[model samples]
Target: MVNINEIARLAGVSRTTVSRALNQSGYVSEKARKKITKVIEETGYVPSEQAKSLRLQRTKVIGVVLPKISTETLGRIVEGIDEILSASGYQILLANSSLNKEKEIAQLKLLESRRVDGIILAATNREETLMQTIRELRVPLIAVGQDLPEVSSVIYDDFNAAKTIMKKMISKGYRRIGFIGVEETDQAVGQFRKQAYLDVMNEENIEIQEGWMQQADFNIQSGEASMEAMLQVCSTRPEAVFAVTDRLAVGAMQTIRKRGLRVPEEIGIAGIGASEISRYVTPPLTTIDYQYEEAGRESARLLLEQLESGKKSVKKSVMNYGLLERDSLI
Candidate 1:
């Protein structure tokens, strides 16, 4: 364990000068900084994170809480966040909430206990508990994907994206279009996308079949199960289905294929969240490009602004959505 004193002695400088040079303090001359850095490299000296944090009153660590880490959209968002945070000399602590409210709250508490400088959350719909916990955190907190009334957030315009997709479907002669999503309380999945679907369907005078509307957790298995159940209602088969996410759409497409149905010919499938996998699927799904990476980058930028400004004002950022047309729907 090489200490600052040893580095100072070896570099033929005082401990105070070494500390200033190592910390990159303004008082240290360029020549001294270069000398100290060279000596540090040769000695294989590692600075004490505890001492550094104690002096700065910050850990230089940012916590990112995500609903699920395995999903493609979330993964891309993390990549974007890492790209910015790493360049700014900050490290990220990833915590997976597993879409569980309790787990998310617990993770936030743990991060606070670790004295993280800030936190970024890709929250679930049922995040009241997490939101309340965030209010008490000494460090700054930013929400991503879902907005909190009193907190800063970066999100896509899910409502407009859904409405646009539904409108496109209706214009393409999809008279009986079904909606597949999660619970209504889920702001992104259930409320925004589902409401847009219903509003557009009603406005177009399209009759929604009772069994065609379904909600479930965002998972491929849930999507498959929901679509399977929808297929059982023989009286009314939807001409097209709009899933809230690419995973659900992929699952629905698999069900359609299994039943000897062809996409766009027998049953069209479309969804939100244009993940990379969406483009590689058998039919190359048609989906709304939610720009999750852009959301992540914007969230990072917002948090950095808060950190630099040392202000607690809430900010809201909305990203644009694009539609990707493919073989899943004509």
Candidate 2:
């Protein structure tokens, strides 16, 4: 694909001159326009939709900012979003934050600079600075996985799902269930989910131990570390360990086996996000199916609707989930 820079070099002009001539904006001399036109005509150089949108003011590109690109959940969500956007004559411009919260704010500005028609943010943490940034953006946008009154969001039923799964573990005779969770800044995955676990334990009259609650980042290595930490601090080990995500649960399983504990016997383990790899893992993981793909499709639809209707009304769409009672949490 030939870019605008190549066209500028061929036309013997600066990039700004080429942009002005192609977009018919700013000031381009007649001689420069003619030269640019000649080069474009000879090379059949077609401007990108983004470049054209800058002039005509309609780009069919949707910017998607994700926490990271390496997870199965992220992959599935992007696939779902792309399916809908591509069918509607639109494309995705992806920006990965690589798990850095600050980068999410930067990606929003970067996407706006590219003149995208709209944006869909798969956010992790909803910091005040990020919310302020979203308010200032001059385009239609929707969020997924985190709810904010100021922004339209498509999120999972984190609290209910956590409570339901904890009840299930208790029903199966697991008295003390340890929790492996992320930081509390992420409202959906970190705060609400952990709060649900604690609430359920309180309701069931189960003893809560400080050592049984461990914090982990969103990764397999962190899960392993958290599980190890929980075991080290707890004089009496919990019968079950519930992690917030499948990646973390898998890591906990690794640590459990290293300690010669048998799953569902000495210790049971579970996680949310019925990720693709969850079914293949040894003693297939028991988890909650958060319907991430559906969330992506819905977020795309909502953003497109807002773009077409020019409606800025804040809409919140909460998604449902299902429990997969697999071998890991029998």
Candidate 3:
């Protein structure tokens, strides 16, 4: 509860001098600044965050809006963001939008109202309304994982990554390959991965079987249900299934085991998003390592750069992805 007044009284300096020192203003003498700082620290004099923000017109806080807060990929991304922001003396404010456009827009406005210095958004899909709002906002905005054409973004080459995995599977002599993904509205899970699969299959002259392709909500339960549906519908079940995420692959694996099928011997399963659990699963998952943490760190760096430079140049940064082969596929 110690305020600047007590520090001022102890330092025998005027309130103006105390304010200048605390704000790191050039008006304060170096010797006086040190003395005031020592007194403030010794007394534990905490300045009013609201007052400081008002005076400086900067909060030194970054808002991170994640599409799905509970996902493992998002968790690691946030950890990376926190590491970078903490080192830079900036705090993080988190908002979970659950892939809802309305909620995301509301959270953006809330962050703006709180005077956040910048925002890093892990968007669900490209929404024109949300993009327009972000463009009109005063704070620096950086998109992560998904991109807005007019904004700065740090994203993985999702389409190419998926294509690489499909081609690898095909080369390994896996002809009956299935694709389990989220709703097509989700650009990352649907458009990117699904389109890549189709393109690869068509180029390889593989027939497109309706039953081998399924879309769900990108959760374990949805994955399980999708796999079961595929098994029921497909006359010739897929020899390998490529899930859009690790969670989905794990779920599909479980379903396969329950059906008395041995992995790789009977069915092979792989997925995107090389989460931690992917490496620890029973047979270990063969998937693409998207470098979620690197993406997060880069997103933070881009936002910080914009905040410091006061420039709005459109930047598109695509990080590399590695295909991690484990016991599950080979």
Candidate 2 lDDT at 275 equals 92
Q: Report how far residue 245 has shifted in candidate 3, in Å.
A: 0.7
Give the C-alpha miss distance for residue 177 in model 1, angstroms: 0.7
Clashes of 1: 0
Q: Residues 1-330, candidate 2, lDDT per residue (tens digit)?
A: 677898899989999999876664567786777677767766667644434443335567899999988888988889889988998889999999988878889999999987788999998888888989999999988999999758999989999999888988988989889999999999999999999999989988998887999999999999999999999999899999999999999999999999988887789999999998799998999899988889899998898888879777688998989999999876
CA RMSD of all predictions: 6.7, 5.0, 6.2
lDDT for model 2, please. 0.88
10 residues in a row with least lDDT, candidate 1: 48-57
Model 3 weakest 10-residue run by lDDT: 47-56
TM-score on alpha carbons, each prediction: 0.85, 0.86, 0.84
How do all the candidates rank in terms of lDDT, highest first? 2, 3, 1
Error of 1 at 267 (Å): 0.4
Q: Measured by TM-score, how close is model 2 to the native structure?
A: 0.86
Sorting all predicted structures by TM-score, with the top scorer first, yields 2, 1, 3
**What is the C-alpha local distance difference test score of each model?**
0.83, 0.88, 0.85
lDDT of model 1 at position 52? 45
What would the per-residue lDDT of candidate 3 be over residues 1-330, giving only the tens digit for each residue?
667787788877888988876554436665666677667556656555544443445668899998888888999899989888888879999999987889999999988877688999998778688878898889989888776789899988999999988988997899999989887666766788899999999998999787999888868888899899999999999999999899999999989998899897889989999988898988999999988898889988888888778787789999999999887886
**Deviation in Å, model 1, residue 247 alpha carbon:** 0.4
